[model samples]
Target: MVECGAKHLIYVSRSAGKSKDDENFLHELQVHGCRTQTFAEDVADSSLIKKVVQNAAKPIAGVIQMSMILKVQGTWNLHNAIPGKDLDFFVLFSSLSGILGQIGQVNYAAANTFLKAFVQYRYSLGLPASVLDISAMADIGYVSNRPSVLAQLRCAGMQMLKEPDVLDALRLAILRSLPTPSAAYETTSTMATGFHSVSNPAHLATAVATDTSILDDEETSGELLAIQIGKQLLTFMLSTESEEELDLGRAPSDMGVDFLVSIEIRNSWRQSFRSEITVLGILNAHSLKDLGKMAAKNLKEKFERRNEAMK
Candidate 1:
């Protein structure tokens, strides 16, 4: 933070620095002309936070919250501590596990997810906030120490970001949330990385089959999604043993897709995409093409403020 031109920094934690390394780090910062203070107080305790702010070297200009369980109550306290209007940036360091969910870290994921919702709340109030949903780091963190952990993440197709990559992301987050909100800039942004390891051909190949990010337009995505759904319907109906035999324009009713099959399709869709298409709705679809269009329309209507109706 000091390297990025922050002169005065107040560090609050449950405990203050007690190690020789900690003293040396503080000395290093001081040598670089950075004013710093460390407060040992529970962020959950609102009264203690009051004291920290009351004795501030300067009125708090910004906040960068490095997160976890403390994020839950700590974030709320911080929100209450400093008025949003006064802040230049309120940045949260969250993990990708918050969005994708991790196997053994339910508490951690939930905490990170809370920060995301908190950011949204702040945004609705027209305050500046940004959450960095960082992936597992390859070096300089806990994951780097555990080979088993690293292997698991690799197998799951998660790319481990290096320190430099993380720093770059942090720089952008701070830059993007500065000064004032703009028409083009999302005031409350979620910056994330490691969703894809583009450098690895094997990883790219594994993700490419269902990855829609490669498509720059939603129209193409909708079309592809429709085709994928249609293929699933074909296999469900047992229309033929081959994908080529499935008629795209043939009505579901003509192909003997009864109420039972419609129910199954509806359930399958709900399981996959949280689709709310009713059994009757599926049966009434004029053709396989219409079914896809119906799904597309449903999506647009459900997610968009304004939508085009199917003729």
Candidate 2:
């Protein structure tokens, strides 16, 4: 946030840093010429929270709440602390469970549901707010720590969301200029809500049967699907932080698509997008767009043959 003009930083943690890692962290910030304060106490502790406002180093800033059952209390504490203050953004880290109604997570879902309502409350007061109903991630955070949870999620046919995807959502939340992802539903300046992952193929089929939910134009377009496939290719090739709208004209081989990753690309897209993309095709493709278009055409033919058989 120092890059975004937030010179002074504050931390509200259960434990104050007194380790070597802490020193290194502080040193890094010092190198960047940023000031920071650590309010070494629980945000749930209203009394300690008061002291944070009273003891300001170089003024303070706005709400970005990410807690469990204490989400309501922590956010309340922050909202109570800074009343009538203009905040650039108030981001709440929520979960898909709350929206999709997960079983055996009554309290967990309730806490997240409060974040949904809280954003609306902020809107009522003419304050900026954004809540992300984030999905299960493959790496980092709670899911990565547990194999069983990850297995269960996979068993449920839920596609795992990656860190870059969450970052993209955050960017959309903070900066409205970026176009919302095609799958985003019920989104506005204050909120971008929904999890396409949890809505399994079976569920989608049911929805289609009931005429309750229909696939949009983006989902049906071969060109758009090609772009999506291209992004998946780029994601596998490069690091998480990258341009989703990267130049499609660039050759895949030039972008580090070796023999092994080419095989992986073919296999993965074969199962997901149901394309006949070969390892050789990926390596020999003139451009990423060309590969995507080839995959899209293969998928189209597959769907056509299936339709003919059904008829």
State the lDDT at 137 in candidate 2: 86
Model 2, span 1-311: residue lDDT tens: 56556678877777556668777887788789888777668989888888887887755546567675578899888777765345666778888777776889988888888887877676666666778788788887778889999999988977677775666456545542112223333335433233553222232222222121122222233343445556666667675646545667778787777998888777777666554667888888888667655654555455556646755
Which pairs clash (backbone N, Cα, C closer than 3 Å) in model 1? none
Report residue 92 deviation for candidate 2 (angstroms).
Answer: 1.0
Writing each residue's lDDT as its tens digit, candidate 1 over 195-293 gives: 763222222122222221222233443344455566677767776646446666777788788998888888876655444888888888787776655
**How high a TM-score does candidate 1 get?**
0.59
Clashes of each: 0, 0
Instruction: Tell me how far the alpha carbon of residue 284 in candidate 1 is from the true structure, in angstroms, after superposition.
Output: 60
Question: Candidates' lDDT values, in order?
Answer: 0.70, 0.64
